[model samples]
Target: MSKDPDLELVKRFKEEGSLESFRALYERYKDKVFSTAFAICGNYAEAADVSQETFFLIYRKIKRFSFKSRFSTWVYRLTVNVAVEKRRSRKEFLALSEIGEEVFEHTGDTPLETLERTERDALLNRSLRHLSPKLRTVIVLRYFQGLSYEEISSILGISMGTVKSRLFRAHRELSPLLQRPPFSAPPGGQEDAWQGN
Candidate 1:
């Protein structure tokens, strides 16, 4: 297949009902779609279902594609939307009560090191989970998927400024989660107390 052949295949499929064209498009984008879905859904089974649903929707709606953007970007946007909707629907069944506070406990040699690492990772995850879906999506697309801001804007159907704003907000929200422990005292306090000078 040629570069951007999926777009041509989709165009052909819409015009001629060509199964070959559809198969080619599927082969080209299957992994990308599945990977995007899996990144958001975080489960192989749900990701598989989301991937199938995404392609099914694409097939039904292929005629509506106007070629205003890359087909891959359009498909990725669909995948993200589908994954987010699935997550929202499942949220009610999966309560947040199970998120235990014992995450700081250490289980290996060098307890302090283990504790620090675990706590840091947990705090990051918790902060990410607290972000709005829009902010989280941008962070995931830019950082986890390594997409450029333009690509992310295309995928999300938003202006570049919106992408920048959401990423800035995500980072701003995460900063406190990564800052110094709230109860830590100044360095000189303990030294002054011991010296009594």
Candidate 2:
């Protein structure tokens, strides 16, 4: 028996053509797919479109999903590929400013603190917007998705060294922009600290 928690569901969907299994998978990954799409495409509407299309493609291709990689990794790769293609075809891209609302939530704070936090969030969003897609992808996968370097390399189909280099570049670019103490990696288990949810 495969140790992958989702393997049984995937097998049911792939072999028995079970819609229930597929729906289960969809429920599990919808938010992740949408977030990755939004992070890459940088537009809510476009991300929604990408998410829908990604699921459609997954439904069609699940039969071909080899067990060589984790199902989640394969899904992320599909999402990233779709988002990148969509981005490349478009003439302009928007900054994912909505990310600030989703990521940073300061409740029960003084008005002054709230304002300062908002400004900081805005600065971070703008800084992220300035990074190239390649660099931004590394940042999103590492910090936003809380993926490991090995997982990122697998998802992006890049070498571990390449993933590290891109992350280094992204951090360097964002640091000056987020000045006031400069941007740094979040502590372990706090990967979602930026994400107030």
Candidate 3:
């Protein structure tokens, strides 16, 4: 129920420089690290690279970390920043296969329904490119990860007010793109197919 274990692992690794302790940390957090990266970039290769870089940073800089912030928050900040930096100028298109069904698993009524869900997720991800990095970060943390604004602010080292403002601007910019023609549900699907932002 508590995250104190991560801190304990960090301390153990710092003191003993144990590979087992390092592996323990990576095994525990790898999914969260990878998912956050993929949720933001929407690309598997890019997300894997970001996740690798995050663990690399953790291994190298764990000693410098002050523990002023929670280890999870620090890890997220590093992962998100690195992921965003890696894909900053690249507009690589992601195929539906690259993102798993988790991104498009709302319903599986039929092949047509699955295709519709994939397209809907694809469109939403593509639209995310139009958002500034800060805005996208806020959106991913809030919508994809279901994190509270206070948690996001703590992770990103920003004010809660700034998080709200970014979300507002992001919604404003994303509204038209999201409401465009491709959003119409497939023939067998419901009227409003796309749910998550």
Clashes of each: 0, 0, 0
Better of 1 and 2 by TM-score: 2
Instruction: Write one digit per residue (lDDT tens) for candidate 2, span 25-76.
Output: 9999998898888888877788899999999999999989998888988998
Off by over 4 Å in 1: 1-5, 93-130, 173-197
Q: Which residue pairs show backbone clashes in model 3?
A: none
Judged by lDDT relative to the true structure, which candidate is superior, 2 or 3?
Answer: 2
With candidate 3 superimposed using the best TM-score fit, by how many Å does residue 9's alpha carbon deviate from the native?
Answer: 2.3
Candidate 2, residue 186: CA error in Å?
24
- Over 4 Å off in model 3, which ranges? 1-5, 88-113, 183-197
lDDT of 1: 0.71
Best by lDDT: 2
Superposed Cα deviation of residue 163, candidate 1 (Å): 0.3
For candidate 2, the TM-score is 0.82
Q: State which candidate, 1 or 3, has the greater TM-score.
A: 3
C-alpha local distance difference test of each model: 0.71, 0.83, 0.78
Query: What lDDT tens digits, residue by residue, belong to model 1 across residues 141-193?
Result: 88867878998999888999999999999999877645746233224455332
lDDT by residue for model 3 (1-197), tens: 24655888888898889889999999998988988899777777788899999999999998888877778778888998898788766755342235576534565378888777777777777568667778888998898778788889998889999999999999999897777666564335555434422
What TM-score quantifies how close candidate 1 is to the native fold? 0.64
